[model samples]
Target: MDTDLTPLRDRIDAIDRQLLELLNQRARHAQDIGQHKHRAGQPVFRPEREREVIAKVLQANAGPLLSDGVTAIWREIMSACRALEARQQVAFLGPEGTYSEQAARQFFGSSCSFAACTDLDEVFRSQLSGSSAFAVVAIENSTEGAVARTLDLLLAHPVQICGEISLAIHHNLLRRHDGLDGVAAVLAHPQALAQCRQWLDKHLPGVERRAVSSNAEGARLAAHDASLAAIAGEQAASQYALQVAAPRIQDEAQNRTRFIVLGGQPTQPSGHDRTSLILAVPNRAGAVFGMLKPLAAHGVSMSRFESRPARSGAWEYFFYVDIEGHQDDARVARALDALRQSCAFFKNLGSYPIGRE
Candidate 1:
């Protein structure tokens, strides 16, 4: 139990140093690869190559740490190397710190360049206006469902959905002190607060819930006053040096948010992909069902179906659908062709590989 462990500890430390040197060498090779890709006018991210590398690393890993640990470290390395070749620029809704920013960094890596916009519309505009090559915008949350603002933005913007990123949301009740009894006001982004409404109501019943721009902003505001509490992500609490009164305060145990990547052009089909489209149909009996029938007949599975109020029309709505299949596939093309004739207005929103995390 109390035996000497100095030799093993020293060996482990030596191995870690060697691992660091190997990582540095790998990064240098990655820089050369980036230069080659850039000279050839290729995109920095190659999903296929990444998948291959992850698989290889996972298979080769054999130690105290498992595949997950190795994959996690290598993923960050790949992202950093990719950024060095050409700074991968991503736009997101934020004021420097928000869930969108976190999701963007997780998806694009920390080394990539970032643009924080004031609103969801600005995120789309950044991509459309060529200010940023890609945009990351939240689409839905497990408890709150789809973000209405994001859906509306997609309807108005011509940018295409190129990929999807999912982030696990861990909300914490942060304050200047340890307890919630002395807290007078609770602050959080409107959406963040809404997601944890049930918990807040049960715990801090009479407290005033103030809406702020983001979770990080709420944490910053709470840090300034001992009587104020904030509901935010873990990163916010850490960044603002606030005390976490309650950890994992979200209503659902599996709280997660899905973000969509927006860009000017569609991605090439990577075998398994999802395509999104907006359709406006005549207000008639079985119109919605009729529109969906083509997809059903074509054996295409519908991943998401949402309806939003249509502009320039009286009491009309547009249906946004995410379906399984690439646009170039014969089955998808046939379904789109049939659906186009039944719908008044139809727009393809592009297709991309599905993200798993």
Candidate 2:
């Protein structure tokens, strides 16, 4: 006999039975917790708690399965348990197969409901209108840079950033045809098209590139037209039943996008956390330097700093900054107070756990 997989599979089946029993037990306990939370008027979805559980599961994974594979299995199990508690409806910038929808599903899971929004404004509006409890939208992408519309929406909306998620982007060129002989135009969001600019230039130099509202929308359009190809994530390719003409087409191999979860309430400190702020510096000399000195002196490490034109007047601008400590931390509190006195203005964007891998 070459080998006997029967005995190994039987043992695995026994272990899987035990796991199923434990998972059901966990679900019951989760439902009980949900009941208590509802009675106490607390939010059912706790991102920090979920992060802790994911970290624990990923650490305990030993062999055979990769970290991401294990995480996906655990996420689905957790998603089922959460569904027992209650269904949560989330909205994202979408036309069904967009990256924002993928990010939302990655953060929330398959069991939860999702609503598609045409734009970032619609994402916020859906939540405001009581149509969605939470919203997910991209903040920045490593290859193409910050999404200006998302930044502008954050300024206009009063929502707080409750959680953050980073998604690795692998753009695929999808089409329904057997070959690219007759393909005339490549359609995708401007960002997606730009991310794969080199690849498109090399392969389809003379083909016209058209911008669409979203990559998913492009995929949808491509579904009906044989002459078009969509550059979108794998999920879109699979969802639309399109053949992948090309995959991993982004110019940057390490392409990733940082997305944020927006909700009405702020989050409590989760120990390992980050805080975001939007402030304005005076026009005088060393304005930016003076405004950030307090954070440096207080030992609060800055993670991100960006600027956007302010609505007040010409040449007026606001600075967006992310620092390493929760707002309630003593040093962080002191830094915020000191900055208020030195800066022209400041808006606290809320503190949240630095979302884990």
Candidate 3:
């Protein structure tokens, strides 16, 4: 026989009612703040402020709930309150169920609107054209070093990095049918195909692999054709009404993707921040070292350094660097000034809060 849970259920119900009352109270306070902001001509959403709020809430968290759960709860609460002021419109590459879409939701929460674009170019265009407030685009992955198209777009577009999201990736084999039997062609993005290469080689040796624009697109195709299967996340499976043939089939167990939030305005320093920049140093023998000397002198820490071909028919390259502090910081500003003097081409890609994994 099971012990009675009526009293426990009643207690939880009462607590939930209290939570509802408190949330509404918070929302009303947010609306009052929004009124003041409107009078001051200030923007409704502030990324730096949101970061501080999350950090403070996490610091005060007492236990019971896991850190992730607490973060999610506070994020939703803030999101709801923010919606009372203004709901953000975010853009991402997808029909639906793409990792980029998930990353956008992770950053902005479900209270915001989403504009799904066919390609990365469209994703960037949506925000640049004022159709969306921000664009969440994949920058790099653990298995795949960088998304080359996104990096190139970053160089091409007049956009600024406002925030970031680091999402754990788990690829599942999705199909209309339950088993892998009769699955003719496997569909997925090229990177997803590469990440699960070893698994595919062992499980479905002779199956044809077809590359698509995104995993969600592959999932959409797999939904209609029982002969085709998709390598994507569980979200794709649910979105397309497909069954999971195999779950977490990626070669690496700890695969993750880093997505950057692109916006028109630069973000204010959030104390804990990361500044990104694109540079092309003069083609002198010690030019690269000369450019880096200021960062060392100013005591600025560099987290990432990546080089991409400049495509000018010459052998020149563009270097992308991520530093520890915001560009507004005194040390970082000084380093950036010296860097500008040392480079042939320099582009400050805006500073934003460091994404938590």
Best by lDDT: 3
Residue 174 of model 1, lDDT score = 95
TM-score of 1: 0.88
For each candidate, give its TM-score against the true structure: 0.88, 0.93, 0.97
Stretches of candidate 2 exceeding 4 Å from the true structure: 1-7, 311-313
lDDT of 1 by residue, 1-357 (tens): 324787888888999999889988988999988888779977777754665677778888877787767777777888877776778689988766678889888766788889988778888889999899889999888888888888888888777887888888999999887977888989988888998999999999988999987777788888899889988877777788888899999988899999998873556677778899999888888989998999999989999998888875688998889999888889998999999898888998888877767
Give the per-residue lDDT digits (tens) of candidate 3, residues 1-357.
124887888899999999999989989999999999889988777888998998888899899888899888888888888888888799999989999999988888889999999999999899999899889999998997889999899899789999998999999999998998998999999999999999999999999999999999999999999999999998888999999999999999999999999984677889999999999986779988988899999999999999999998888899999999999999999999999988999999899999888
Clashing pairs in 2: none
Which of the two candidates, 2 or 3, achieves a greater lDDT against the reference? 3
> What RMSD does each model have against the real structure?
2.8, 2.0, 1.5
Per-residue lDDT of 151 in model 1 = 89
Clashes of each: 0, 0, 0
Cα lDDT of model 2 by residue, 183-205, tens digit: 88999999999999999999889
Least accurate 10 contiguous residues by lDDT in model 3: 1-10
Error of 3 at 282 (Å): 2.3
Candidate 1: segments with Cα more than 4 A from true spot: 1-36, 47-52, 59-64
Q: Which of 2 and 3 is ahead in TM-score?
A: 3
